[model samples]
Target: MEKFYPEFSARFAQFLEHIRGRRIAIVGHARPDGDCIGSQVALARVLGTLGHEVLCVNPDLVPRRLQFLVPGMRFARTDEMLADRTDYTAIFVDCADHARAGERLKGRFPVVTGNIDHHLSSAGFAEWNFVDVHSAATAEVLAGMFFDNGLTVDAQTAQGLYTGILTDTGQFRFTSTTRRTFLLAAELMARGAKPTEAGFELYERETTGKLQLLERFLASLRMECGGRVCVGTLPNGIFEATGSTAEDTEGLVDYARCIDGVDVGVLIEERPDGAMKASLRAKNPAFRLDRVAAQFGGGGHACAAGLNYKGGAAGFREKLVAAIAAQIAAVDTPEEKK
Candidate 1:
């Protein structure tokens, strides 16, 4: 409201001047989602247009579906690309915290020149931090920055920005979706973003392997807490059996949340490291899923959050179920009585 962070434009101008003609590394968070990749590519396009050499670096390959939005998004193996970060200006995007950039990159480029993100957990990790958690998407913040700085938004830039907004807001269906989000989407469309094509590519272009993986995940869905919570797990073996990758499981958590009578959805993805990554989503505004995620050292928006647990996969699942149950119990507790 009232134009969150009025000084962002002026500060961004200063950052641009400082990094002109420099070899810049645009880093996104690990296991990047659409918002992460979109913000990175969009910002890279702007930086490149300003006569700066920019490299968009992500630890994981761009999701096959998102590749169409940011064509040829530059990606690098973390161990190889960040081995030496001596002469590069680091700019992080859509990451909540410094650690989200991975320890290797964080160690190499300790001095972050800029950060662009919309998560509340971003506690000013950069010399020039642009964290506006109020904004619906980091792409919304990026779009505002681009317009404020008089940067021309072309097809490539528009596509990237639109993708960031779409995914972060769950195609504008999430509770965070606001009038300003739609206004930003319209602005991006006017700048040549093809929303129709993007919708089909992102939502409709899943491969058979991904579909099978989803089927398996859905098959494992469990309803608990008198059907108020829905839980699903995607084991590593399921990916192998279905010939799917981590990216294929990206939005599968939403499927569980979409079921009737399920106010909270829990998705646990078993990782090769013997750990599980838990993504929690809420259908009811009364639910505070971030609190559930914080039990495992993660924090995010109320409606969406995640946690990483180091334990046997089964043990992690058991712990997560208990955590979710505790959250549900708290919701039913009377405030005054407590």
Candidate 2:
């Protein structure tokens, strides 16, 4: 058990010490992605082994693919957790802010005891915050802490950590993937994480509806800002027509981002209520898509961010394109900063 993130590990150890012997409820964001669910599962299993009563709570059900990581584990939906009315120490995992945990859960735990995340937009809304925007994933932070403290990572917990690291790193292809990420991934594999299993569940299990949804999204691709920006749309009825869901739109935006010469990629999802949810991705961190998303009250990493607007897709797209153009113009004008 070697220490990778010594400073973060020490801080996490102190946080754990403060909550020692208390009943803990681990909270994750609304849409529990691999990193969110994996972090919750891994931390809950580790903390439970440390003699604390722990349960993972989320606003939504675990996505179909991520369910495997929670097999035989204690996971409660937000409603269920609220029904308990139990007094417990609240720990949030992979949530950039308390709002990301949903308004209901945010109200339940007005003051978070512990907050662990890796999103650059994290609001640090906890008494004990261990946010590492540089880390690839929240699970990466917890994995480092687990190993640093000589804690045991059982097979299931290892799989959870491995899945988080794998997905958050974009299969280890994202810029955030560091040498420590690879090394910790290797350690998780040694501890019993099966990459093949994770890959099959994550990538190979795409549904036909998702493909149909992706088709519509691709068909809506439009280049702006002299082709440096690529924007796509999923119309209001597209999901219902394709029998797909919000989860299906997960990696669809990447298709636009991966295109040659596209520095910024945007996916605008039109909700049933006419609101538009925009997911933004950039190849270079300098673009600072997070700041761009913040203009619409959304936040995320520099390379990947999102926002929601209560307006028509056409108008939202126009406004977003203009914002992105301004960003590109500002970046091009290095003299402005000076």
Candidate 3:
């Protein structure tokens, strides 16, 4: 067992020491991806082994594909956790900001005990913030730290960590994937993570409606920003028409980014409430799609980010396209930073 993340391991020890006795709540972001859910499952299992009473809470229900990671009522909805009288010292996993867990959960835990994440845009929001932007996924950081600490990683926990790494790395095809990423994944495999099942469940299990939904999304794709970017829109009620849920939109933005000469890809989902959710992806970090997203009160990794906000007088799609175009313009003209 090598010390893959010695410094983070040390901080994890300190985090454990700080919340030694109080009941701990592990909170995750709304509409959590694999990284969010995986980190929550891994942290809960790891902390539970330490004899601490732990609970996992999320603003949204676990997506269908990720249901395997949640075992036997391990996760609770925001209202469910709030109903419990037990006071919880919260630890946020894979959340870029304290508000990433949504306002209600943020209200539930006024004082954050810890936050573990790997998003490039992550701010140190918790008392014990363990944010390693270099790590491909927060689960990668946790897996390395858990191994470095000589902690136990059961099969389910290993599966969760592996899934998080797999998804966040774009199946190990993203630039963030490194030798260390592969090494940690191999170690997780040795610890009983089944890649075949993870891959099959995550990828091969797509429903027909998801396929139709993806078709609609791709059909809406248009080249924007002088062919440097591709944009797609999923209209409100498209989910109902296609018999799909919001989770089916996963990986749709990648198709836009895969187009030739497109430096950035955008997906704007029109919600039923006149609000919008957008996902941004870039072929290069210099495009700084996260910075583009930050303009709309959302942030994430440099190459990948998202935001959910109501469209204003200017229109969200028009505004978002302008922001992205501006980002590209800045990159195109290096002298524009002023």
Candidate 4:
């Protein structure tokens, strides 16, 4: 098999050697998405097969669509795991930083054994970090590593990996989707990953409440920066009114980003406690929205990023628009015209 990440092959080998017989905690980010949950499931299953006692940990329950992937296993929530106080070697998957796994999880497991991720904003906060920013998804990185190292990737594990790649690449529509992405996906299919099943479950199973939430989000869209940017908001009480939760807000920002003239899109969610969480997406990678997210101490890929703020949604919107508008102006500025 072709080694997509040659540099990390030996490191993965060493990682396997270190955790062979140890109790392992496979941690994923908060409000886990397809890639995050998929990486956790696949890695936990792989490690379990190798004689390790593996437990998947997350700050939130698996989203409805992803629950099917972890049928026989259980995801140990941070609160419950903290209650147990079991000792394990912590390995973070799909988390850009330790805190992305949630403050409590990071606090409970201050020392990390290994980190595997594909986000540009990853801080390498572990003893061994395998971050491939070029990979479309963390599942892609793990798939390549497993194949290269001759590890067993069974049908269920393949489904988990395939689902991660499928969603993270927007069904191969994102610019981040590369030839290697397609190749790895094909390999996974051969290993028993049913795209028909994954697609039907992920897309065709949307609930009426989710559609109501989407309608509300679309109605809130506001154009900025001469229509080059679009922003929307989900007020604190909107979730209750629409019978939705934060997970239902997933992919809502894409609607703002996919507009023809829009170069960037934003989604702001107001919490009950006056805290705001914002999701940012851009059409081009050069926009480096990750840096924009970093200004507020959040992190993600260049094209997609997020941040949290301790202020009202309106104030955060003003600050975020100004930052995004400044970036647009810089991009429009003529070099020699100076």
CA-only RMSD, every prediction:
2.4, 1.5, 1.7, 1.7
lDDT of 1: 0.82
Clashing pairs in 3: none
Provide the overall lDDT of each model, using Cα atoms, as 2-decimal numbers.
0.82, 0.90, 0.90, 0.90
| Model 3 vs. true fold: TM | 0.96
Per-residue accuracy of model 2 over 111-164 as CA lDDT, tens digit each: 899999999989899999999899999999988889888888999999999999
Q: How many residue pairs clash in each candidate?
A: 0, 0, 0, 0
Ranking by lDDT: 2, 4, 3, 1
The TM-score of predicted model 1 comes to 0.92
In terms of lDDT, which candidate is stronger, 1 or 2?
Answer: 2
Candidate 1's residue-wise lDDT over 100-150, tens digit each?
A: 878877787788988888886777889998988778788889998887777
lDDT of 4 by residue, 48-153 (tens): 7899888999999999999878987769998898997779999999999999988999998999999999999789999999999989999999999998888899
Q: What C-alpha root-mean-square deviation, in Å, does candidate 2 show against the real structure?
A: 1.5
Q: Would you give me the overall lDDT of model 4? A: 0.90
Model 1, residue 284: displacement in angstroms? 3.4
